[model samples]
Target: MKQICVFILVLALTSCEYFNAKKTTPEAILNEELQTFNWNDVDVYPTFSECDSIETKNGKTTCFTEVLTTHILEKLQKDSIVVTQDVTDTINLKFQVSETGILSLLNIDTDSLIMKEIPNIEALIYSSLDSLPKVFPAIKRGQQVKTEFELPVIIQAN
Candidate 1:
């Protein structure tokens, strides 16, 4: 019994160094991971209910783009826009999707000529997106995160 006790004490003393080693905090690990991570890409793209069924990233992205473009076009058509002069412009629409799936416009880059032709283009785009269906926020690292996306909308008039 005495020999056994002495052996156990020696083992415990040697193992003390293992317990005293520095421990990393959760914040430190997260900061390091975030530093090395690519923020431009997401594990899963934001999805509309109609797009949730799609499994591939590109599929979901295509669906989302189609739905968004269709909605915007529909809104523009509903306005019965009639341009006096031929206008062709590609508007870069920048928007952010919240972690909770809400979408909001950040900026709209349109040619002055297009804006002059369709004065209410901004409002139309805003209303169309405001009425969009519920969205599922983008996923990053298994957590829902806000994401910004830019879509180019082409406007042409004869």
Candidate 2:
């Protein structure tokens, strides 16, 4: 009984150190070297909804779906990249936001009559990413979620 009590006491004391050693310090987590994304001026339309909420970690804000769509559309228009086709638009982009608030492309689909200028269309998406806002609420529970951003790039002559 005495030996059991001694062993338990020693285990308890050593366990603290073990846990501490395994834990990562806040500084280690916040250091620029450890960060994956660098936030810049990305134009994102932020929508506040039950599904959308702001996450303020490391002094940064992430926007959600509808707002992101609006922001992207605005970006495309600002660049004057008009779609020179009068057809059905079917383009979808699926990507993930890194911990540091950078977009990492997961999938892109460009299969539609509307996409005549494939290369330019792609460029528009990439260019707009800089101003793209982060998804809000930070995808609870799951490590990843599927979010789609669709656009119909149409060009009309004056």
Query: Which runs of model 1 end up more than 4 angstroms from their true locations?
Result: 1-28
Model 1 lDDT at residue 2: 98
lDDT of 2 by residue, 93-156 (tens): 7766643445555666776443554447677777777765444423323333333333333333
Off by over 4 Å in 2: 1-63, 82-84, 134-158
Which has the greatest lDDT? 1
Best by TM-score: 1
Give the per-residue lDDT digits (tens) of candidate 1, residues 1-158: 99999999999999898889698999999999989999899999988899978989999999998888888878777777788999888999998999999888999999999889889889888988867888889999999999999999988776
lDDT scores in order: 0.89, 0.52
RMSD of 2: 11.5
Superposition error at 71 for model 2 (Å)? 0.9
The pairs that clash in candidate 2 are 42-131, 43-131, 45-67, 63-134, 63-136
